[model samples]
Target: MKFIPFYLIFTLLIFVQACGNKQVEENKTQREQVIAVHDEVMPKMGQLKSLEKAALQKAEELQNSETPDQAKIDELKNLASQLNLAYEGMFVWMRQYNTEDGEKTPEEVKVYLDEQLVLVSKVNEDIKAALAKAEVLLKD
Candidate 1:
């Protein structure tokens, strides 16, 4: 009778350990899938950022030119399009920054996102300043 109780206790312990391992494995698999998806997405955002930078360059060139030409206008329009796309990506990232987001690490993701916020702010301010200066040029 004494042996029976000990045997039952040991069996219960083994069952619990098996269940815990299964749960851990399942969690790991889910995390992997999420990371795989985010890996593909981050690069696309990077491309958009590149385009946005090119657009900003175009606007700056136009501002420095003695006379605003047709080419300047065309470049501005192209820059605006790239800026819009980049802004879209920024908004999407902001929306997901708080959630699990399938990101690599929550802490690392926050750092990346905070840096992006600063960059985006600077880009927006540049666009505003450019527009203001361009308006003055157009008036004169």
Candidate 2:
């Protein structure tokens, strides 16, 4: 009877340890997924800055011209604003990122990462749109 109880305890302990290890592995995977999305989008930040600068210059030139095209200037201004917002969103997301809460678990990390993937996808799309719009405007 004593051996049976000890065996049950040992089995339970092993099961608990295995569960913990699985959670740790899951957390690592979730973290990697989040970082992957971030890495994919971060390199585009420089391009966004360049586009913003070009848009600003173009807008300034239009304003200084004898017959400024108000409509074009407004479009460029809007593009600049959107680019700024996209950059700001990335910066804010990085600053606010935290998955190490005391009460949080690996499941929570997975949930957070899943949500972040959607947000990062949208940010990338916005960056692409801004780049395309800026390119067409700068060409003219």
Candidate 3:
């Protein structure tokens, strides 16, 4: 009978350990997802700067023209602003993101990662939208 009680305790311990491991794995997966989104957009930082500069240069050139199109100059300037905003957004996200678990529990870590994924995903969208708009504008 005593041996039976000890076996039950051991089984419970094993189950608890397994659950903890699963939680850790889940957190790892979520972290990876956040990083994936960040990686997708990070390479575009340089492009964003280049596009912003190009937009400003085009706007300036238009402004200097004898028959300057004020409307087109305004549009190019606006596009430059949007590109700069998107570029800044990435830096802001990187500044605020924390990868350390510190004293947080697994559940807390999961929540933090979830929030980060949402933020990074939004940043990704902003980057893509700005890049697309710039491309369309500069193509002309």
Question: What TM-score, over all chains together, does every model reach?
Answer: 0.43, 0.81, 0.92
The full ranking of all candidates by lDDT, starting with the best, is 3, 2, 1
Error of 3 at 93 (Å): 0.6
- Clashing residue pairs in candidate 1 (N, C-alpha, C atoms within 3 angstroms): none
Model with the higher lDDT, candidate 2 or 3:
3
Model 1 reaches what TM-score against the true structure?
Answer: 0.43
Clashes counted in candidate 1 amount to 0
lDDT of 1 by residue, 1-140 (tens): 88998999999999988876675565456545444444434445544555556556666777778886777667566655645654474566446544443644444544555555554455444444444444443332
Per-candidate local distance difference test:
0.56, 0.82, 0.96
Can you tell me which runs of candidate 3 are displaced by over 4 Å?
A: 1-6
Q: Candidate 1: lDDT over CA atoms? A: 0.56
lDDT of 2 by residue, 67-113 (tens): 99999999999989888888887887788677564677666766776
- For model 3, what is the C-alpha lDDT against the true structure? 0.96
The residue-by-residue lDDT of candidate 3 on 1-140, one tens digit each, is 87999999999999999998899999999999999999998999999999999999999999999999999999999999999999999999999999899999888999999999999999999999999999899997
Clashes of each: 0, 0, 0
Clashing pairs in 3: none
